[model samples]
Target: MLVDDQVPIEEFEGTEFPSPATVHMELRYVDRLLHIEGTVDADAKGVCDSCLDDVERHIHVDVDERLDPHSDRENDPFGESNVLAGNRLDLADLAQQLVLSDMPMGLRCSDECKGLCGICGANKNTGGCSCENDTENHGEPKMEDAAQ
Candidate 1:
C-alpha cells in the first residue's frame, strides 16, 4: 500500500521545523516483516552553533525500515523498531524519529564562519570586535606597566 501524509512535529534534535514534514512512502507486508520505504521533506529553523546566527535549511530524509509487527520494541532497548504498537503503526513518531536520526549535530551556517568573540561577545564573521586586538602580547600589558 502507498501512504501519503503530513506529520506535525515540534522539533527534532533541538531544531524546530517551520512546518509539518510531508511523508511519502510505500509500505508492504510480507510474511512476518513489514517493509517501509519513503522520503520526508522538512524546513528546519535553527541557530548556527558557531556565529549564533539564524539558519534555515530544507532537509530531505530517506526512510527505510524493516519492522516485525509482532516484536515488542519497548522490552528491547536496543531494538530498532519503536513506532509500532501491536498491529498499528505510529506514522508521526516514525517521521520524527527518522528526521531526528538523520539530523546533524552542531550545525554551522557556513564552514567559513568566524564564530563569536570571547572577550566582547561579538560575531567575528561580521567584522570582529575591538577587545580582541586591544590586548596585545598574549593579553599581557608588559610587566613594568602592570607593576605601576
Candidate 2:
C-alpha cells in the first residue's frame, strides 16, 4: 500500500519545521510484520545558532520501520519493537519522529557565518564595528607581555 499526504507543520509543536511537510509511505505487510519505508520533505525555519538570524532550511528524512501487529504486549513490557495498534497506523506521528531525529543539532544559515560581535552585538558578517577588536582574549597572553 502506498500513502501520500501533506501534513500541516503547525499541528506539531516544538518542531523546527515552519511549512507544511510532505510524506510518502510504502507499506508491505508480510504475515504479522508490517514493513514501512517512506520519505519526509519540509522547510524548517529556525534562528541561526551563530548569528541569531532567521534561517530557512530544506530538510529531507528517510523513514524505515518494522512493526509487529501480533507481538505479546504483556511479555514485552517496554515495547522494544514497534507495534501496531489494532489495524491502524499513525503515519503523522511516524513522520514527525523521523523528521525530528534527522534535524541538525545546531541550525545555521551557513558554515562560514561570521556571527555577532561579543562586545557590541554587531553583525560582523555585514560590516565591522568599533567594538570588533575590543573584546578581551581570555587565555592568550598579550603581545606586550610576550615581548616583555
Candidate 3:
C-alpha cells in the first residue's frame, strides 16, 4: 500500500513549518509482520538560539519500522516490535514523531553568527554597540585599582 498526503503543523505545538509537510508512505505486509517505510519533507521555521532571529531550515527524514499486529502484552511485554492498533494506522502521528526525532537540538542562522549583546540587547552581527567595550572588562578589576 502507498500513501501520499500533507500533514498540518497545527497538530504539533511549539513547532512551525512554512507549509504542510509532504509525506510519502509505503507499507508491505509479509506473514504476520507489517513493514512501514516513508519519507517526510518540510521547511521548518524557528528562532535562532543565540540571536533570536527567525531561521528557516529544510528538513528531510526517512522512516522505517516493523509492526506485529498479533503481539500482545502477555507475550511481548517489552514490545520489541511495535503493535498495530486495530486495522488502521495513523500516518500523520508517525510522520510527526519521525520529524521531531530528526530535528536539530539547536537552530542557528549561521555558524559564525554574532549573538545579541547581553547589556544593550543589540545584534552584534549588524553592528557593534557601546556596551561591547564595557562588557569586555566586566569581571576584571583595573590593574592600578588592584595595586592600590
Candidate 4:
C-alpha cells in the first residue's frame, strides 16, 4: 500500500540528483517493511589524490532495499533521524543506505592520474613545470617511487 497520495517520494529521485542522468523507482509497503527498487545517476567531484586538481566522475546507482523501522539505533554516528517510529516511516534512511553502501572508497577521475609534482607543487596532470630538485638536502627516498 502507498503511504501518501498527495506527494510521491518517487518524484524526488531525478530532481534531487539531476546530474546523475536518470532515476526510476518502485516502492511497496508490506509487513512493516518497505521494499524499494530504483536506479540513480550520480556525479562526484573531489580533489585528485595525485595532482590535487579538481576531479569529477559520474556513476550509476542501482537501488534495491528492504527497510524496517529501527528504533534502537540512537547511538548511530550519522544521526538519529535515519530511523522512524510508530507506523509512520521515513524513506530517507533507505535512500541513504543505498547511496552509502555502494559509494566507491577510492574515487579518481582516471587510474593513471599524474598528481602534483613534489618539488614545485605543479599539477602534473597538466604538464611540466620547472622546479628545483632537492635530492641532497631532503635526503629522503622518493615518496612516489616508494608507493610504486
Highest TM-score against the true fold, candidate: 1
User: What's the distance in Å from true for residue 37, model 1?
Assistant: 0.7
- For model 4, what is the alpha-carbon lDDT of residue 140? 53
Q: Is candidate 1 or candidate 2 better by lDDT?
A: 1
Clashes of 4: 6
- The number of the candidate with the highest lDDT is 1
Model 1, C-alpha of 60: deviation from truth (Å): 1.0
Candidate 4 residue-wise lDDT, 20-121, digit = tens: 234456768778566657765555555555665666666556766665544424434354434443444444444444444455565555788877778778
Ranking, TM-score, top scorer first: 1, 2, 3, 4
Lowest lDDT 10-residue stretch of candidate 2: 77-86
The residue pairs that clash in candidate 4, if any, are 20-41, 20-42, 50-115, 50-116, 51-115, 51-116
Residue 50's lDDT within candidate 1 is 87
Arranged by lDDT with the best first, the candidates are: 1, 3, 2, 4
Q: What is the C-alpha RMSD of each candidate to the true structure, in Å?
A: 4.6, 3.8, 4.4, 8.0
**Which tens-of-lDDT digit does each residue in 37-114 have in candidate 2?**
988898888888888888888879887888776663354534623334445666666666677667778888798998
TM-score of each: 0.79, 0.74, 0.71, 0.54
**Every candidate's lDDT:** 0.82, 0.72, 0.74, 0.52
In the predicted model 1, the residue pairs found to clash are: none
